[model samples]
Target: MKYDPIDSNLFKKNRKKFMAQMKPSSLAVFNSNDVFKTGADSTMPFKQHRDIFYLSGADQEDTVLVLFPDCPDPAHREVLFVTETNDHIAVWEGEKLTKEKATEVTGIETVYWLKDLDKKFFEMMTQCDTVYFNTNEHYRQAVEMETREDRFIKKTKAQYPAHNYAKSAPILQRLRAVKEPEELELLQKACDITNHSFRRVLDFVKPGVWEYEIEAEYLHEFIRRRSDGFAYTPIIASGNNANVLHYIENNQQCKDGDLILMDVGAVYANYSADMSRTIPVNGRFTDRQKQVYNAVNKVKNEATAMLVPGTLWKEYHVEVGKLMTSELLDLGLLDKADVQNENPDWPAYKKYFMHGTSHHIGLDTHDYGLLWEPMQANNVFTVEPGIYIPQEGFGIRLEDDVVIQESGAPKNLMGDIPIEVEEIEDLMNK
Candidate 1:
């Protein structure tokens, strides 16, 4: 791992919190993500399943974590299974985690090799009356591939059909939504790396530069600063390309006076930071562009203030819609009739600002908070508001990751990144 070692206590605390919500005499299991294959003799990079990593801090493949808080045997209460390392394997694939190393990384005293998982897990399953299986239930999840957890759950059900099965997603959804102090530190580091990279891009971007070149600049600075590349597929959309919500071609040349909408972030220690900043290609925004940019920035600021505790995600967006409507009205994008006759379900602001204002941002780009639940302290979210004007050939979006606080306003993780029109103009020209 390029990132520094995290304290195992964070994982320990996460496991304790998860187990506290488990049903009596129940055991929960989490599996590391499968190393997917790209083609023959080649494989995609291994990305550990966020849930297992959140609970164990074991950032490796072929690992399993089991939690049985009410186990009769204390040693079996918290167990970690890792792929055993050997001399030949170490020489070929570098060192895998050993039992001692796994213990140190995870703070789980009991460690076993993956080869013994069937035998050990069967023994534990016989004692527990219920089993908790980790499943992907994120609102945006559209996975078609069968994950390691899916296979485990399928086989476990066939092996022990009579055992009461429960979903770990609900428990994890609530717990992972809120960030730990350690997690907050990691997120801040990711945001800091993103900040540095954006500043670098600000200096690199110029009229006639290809969009991909700007993407390369961000990637270079990210790896240089110990980040694991981008948190999500970056959007380096310039001009009309910005009108497409997920434009990633990054092949167009940024013409002078056109705006480049960059929705990019850097990842550190498996934590994610999401930021979106739209800037001019020629180092100066046109008067009309400045008008739209400031409107979007104002909407972002007001929306960020609403991320404090007790704010419901749905209601927060509704309030943001109203704020955007006012901005659109002042910008002349919408008239009074557009607001009066507009469908309540689809407000007049939707014509300009289409996407949601904010979402939980952490482990994954679109992290794990339940939208229906009221906001709480330590819940990290992204406040992104944009106005896409295809006719004008540009879009303006200003986003920042923030942590909801117990009192007062939320803390912006990307607060130091250049956002104001004047600041961005100054940095780009410098």
Candidate 2:
């Protein structure tokens, strides 16, 4: 891990919260993500499963966590199973976590080797009345590839068909939605790193710089600030390229008159921050570009104000659409006729700002939170609003991560980053 270690108390608290929701006399299991293969000899980087990481603070692959709060033996209540490290494995790969290190990282005193799992698990299965299966239940999930957790769930069902089974997703969703104080601290650290990266790009960007060059500048700043890397794949699209929502081919040279849309953020200790900003490549937006940019910025500001506790996720977007429509009308992109004649399914605002204005952001870039439920305090989200105009050969978007406060409006974590046209221009010219 490039970043510093996280405090294990957060994991301990997470485990307690999760166990509180489990049925009595039942056990829950979580598995680390697989190290996917790219070719015969190559493999993709290993990313720890967020659920296990949240509960155990174990970031390595082939690790397992078993929680049985009602166990007769207190030490066995919260157990960790890790891959045993040997001389050969250590020499060939790297230093795998030792039993002592695993205990330190996870706060679970009982650590066992992977080899002893089957024998140990068989004994525990008979002792418990029910088993909790960890399944992906995110609203936007389209999981085709079977994860290690999925395979474990299938195998456990086949082995013990008579045992009662339950889904752990519901409990996890509710618990993970509200951030602990420690988690909020880590997430704030991530947003602070993103601020450094964006500020660096403000000075480096100019008319002649390529889009890829600006992306490189952000990456450079992120590493300097001890961030692991971007929270997600970044989009550094300029001019009409910005119209492509997910554009990542940043090969175009930024023209002086065009605006560059950069959607990027940094990750630290598995926590994520998401931000998007559109700036002129020439260190100044043209008159018309400023108009569109200010419109998008206004929508972003208003939309963020609506992310208070008790706000419904569905209703929040409807309100954002109204805000975007009013801004678009003021910018001359939509008229009175465009408002009335537009289809109800796709409002007049869709013609300019097509995508959702915000989404829950945290551990993962698009973090987990039940959309059907009302928003709550400590639930972090991204307020991003944009105007894509292929006809004008440019697009503008502004986004920032915010934490919903218990009282009053949500607090913007990226508040230090420059966004207003005057602030951005002054910084760039400096």
Candidate 3:
């Protein structure tokens, strides 16, 4: 891991909170993510499962966590099963966590090799009537590939069909939504790294530069600062390409009058920071570009202010749509007739600012939070608003990560990053 070690107390607290929510006499299991294959003899990078990482602070593959708070055997109450490391394995791969190292990292005193898992798990299963399965239930999830968790669920059900099963997603969704103090610190670090990368890009961007070059600059800056590259696949959209909400080809040359929409971020210690900024390729926005940019920035600011405790996620987006509508009317994109005739389901503002203004942001770029529930303090989110004007040959979007606070306004994680029109122009020219 390029990032520094995190305090294990956070994980300990997370596990305690999760266990408190579990049904008595029930055991929960979490598995690390699989190292997916690219092709023959090649594999994609391993990413730890967020749930396990949140509870155990274990960031390695082929690891499992078993939690049984009411277990008769105290040692089996919280057990960590890790892949055993040998001389040949250590030589081929870097140092794998040993039993002592695992205990230090996870705060779980009982550690067993992977081979002992079946025997130990069988013994525990006999003691518990219910089992908790960690399933992906994020609202935005569209997973088709079977994960390691999926394999575990299949094998467990086949082995013990008579045992009662429950979903762990609901508990995790609620718990992970609210940030612990330590998690907030890691998120701030990620945003700081992202700010550094964005500032570097401001100086590096110019007319005739390829979009990919700008992407490379961000990667260089993020990696140098101990980040785990981008939190998501970056969108380095230039010119009208920004109209495509998910543009990531990054093959276009930025023309003199083009506006580049960079939807990028940096990840530190598995925490994500999401930001979006549109800047002129030639170091100055045209009058019309400035108008659109300012409009988006205004929407972003107004939307961010609405992210307070007790706000409903669904109602919050509707309110943001109204804010965008006012901006669109001011921009002459929508007139009185357009507003009167527009459907309430798809408002007049959908013509320009089509996407949702905010979403919970954290471990995953689109982090987990129940949309039906009211927003709460310490929940972090991204405030992004945009206007995609294909007819004008440019698009503008502004985004920042924010933490909902108990009073006043949500705290901006990307507050130090340049956002004002003059600030961006001055930095680009310098």
Instruction: Give per-model TM-scores.
Output: 0.99, 0.98, 0.99
Q: Comparing candidate 2 with candidate 3, which one achieves the higher lDDT?
A: 3
CA deviation > 4 Å runs, candidate 1: none
Distance from true position, residue 311, model 2, in Å?
A: 0.8
| Residue 227, model 2: Cα distance from true site in angstroms | 1.5
lDDT of 3 at 423: 99
Better of 1 and 3 by lDDT: 3
What's the CA error at residue 226 for candidate 2, in Å?
A: 1.8
**Which candidate number has the best lDDT?**
3
Taking all chains together, the TM-score of candidate 3 against the true structure is: 0.99
- List per-candidate RMSD values in Å: 0.8, 1.1, 0.7
Candidate 2 C-alpha lDDT tens digits along 216-318 = 9988988888888888899999889999999998999998888999999999999998999999988888899998888888888888889998999999999
lDDT of 3 by residue, 1-430 (tens): 9999998899999999999999999999999999999999899999999999999999999999999999999999999999999999999988999999999999999999999999999999999999999999998889999999999999999999999999999999999999999999999999999999999999999999999999999999999999989999999999999999999899999999899999999999999999999999999999988988998898888898899999998999999998898999999999999999999889989989888888988888999898899999999999999999999888888999999999989999999999999999999998
Q: Cα deviation of 136 in candidate 3 (Å)? A: 0.8
**Number of the candidate with higher TM-score, 2 or 3:** 3
